[model samples]
Target: MELNYVISITDRDQIQELAALFQSLELNMGLAMLGKGTATSEQLSIYGLSNTEKAIVSTVADGESARQLFRAAKRKLFMDIPGNGIMLTVPIKSVGGGRTLAYLTGNKTPAGGAPDMNFEHELIIAVLNEGYSDAVMDAARTAGAGGGTVLHARGTGTKQAEKFFGVSLAEEKDILYIVATAQQKAAIMTAINKTTGAGTKAGAICFSLPVSQVIGLRKMDDN
Candidate 1:
């Protein structure tokens, strides 16, 4: 079966409802993180989003179940309506081992196949030192990125991480998520790396993921 990593971002007030929705869908292994939207006042107005705390929820599911979850979220939570939330799925290429795969997939048989690559947009994720989100967002904006979400996080094994990445890393981190068009991904990533990457105060590490499906960004698309 094809596996997908599903991510949902919504207002903090809606987290409980979203969690119950996930439970009804059997997406039990999900995690929720507190985050804040990075949109400016004007941008927030344009997107019909209020300046409120956000929740970032993620989970793994088979392709079919992922689709079902998306549909249910749209119908039950009005996720398709602007200001409700956004949901997206990224294809999972592989997992660790048999038992690991079974646990993630709920014991479904594993299958190997080429990932779908015909997506028009991708999700760019950046990990940076805490309090450096402003610098990262500034760089990203220069490369045509509109807005992003910032999640506060704590890191482990920093000593080893510093040796591997050749840069000092703090335990406190900020994970920034930017969804941009495929055409904009490279430039945004390059800009971020040049301005905030290793050796810089931000010391950011950036990467991209294929977004097989997404919703609640009609305003972005219209722009």
Candidate 2:
């Protein structure tokens, strides 16, 4: 089945509520990270941001479930209120390998013949050892990536990840987010992998998600 990534950036105190909401919706796979909003004093005042500390919640859901979750979040989390938060979804091209895919999809693949390719933009996400966001960004920039957002996170492992990736995983993590055109996604990911991949202290894993819409980013001609 096709998947979409639902991301919510909201007040730190509201994270638990959203986590419970996701659980109620049966979207078992989720992650939360700590971050600080990058608004100036004037901007914060304009947006009514009393606090800058933020929690970023991410999860995977089917299209229908994603729509339901977004609607529920807007009402329950007060996302319509200024400075409350923002929610967005990015379509996933594919997820997991053979056996892993089976486990993730419960052995039932979507009836679509094969995944289609009509998206123009992608969100490149890189999760790495803590404090390596700058390094990742530098690498990405060299490969045509522009500015990105960084979030402080912690990783939990059910299995020994060191055995699988040949590098010890760090509980403290940093997630770097870069949005680029589809043509630049591969190059950006390749740069990140080379400098921060398993062999490095960063132990980074990079992936991309299709972006179906963009609002704030400026048009190329405008730049």
Reference-based lDDT, each prediction: 0.86, 0.72
Question: Per-residue lDDT for 22 in model 2?
Answer: 86
Taking the tens digit of each residue's C-alpha lDDT, what string does model 2 give over 4-71? 77777777898888898888887767798877554546645765646457777888777667777877
Tell me the tens digit of each residue's lDDT in model 1 across 120-181: 88999999999999899989999998778899988764687688776654578899999888
Give Cα distance to truth, residue 223, candidate 2, Å: 17
Least accurate 10 contiguous residues by lDDT in model 2: 213-222
Residue pairs with backbone atoms closer than 3 Å in model 2 (clashes): none
Off by over 4 Å in 2: 102-109, 113-149, 153-209, 213-223
* Structural similarity to truth (TM-score) of each candidate: 0.88, 0.56
Q: What lDDT is obtained when candidate 2 is compared to the true structure? A: 0.72
Top candidate by TM-score: 1
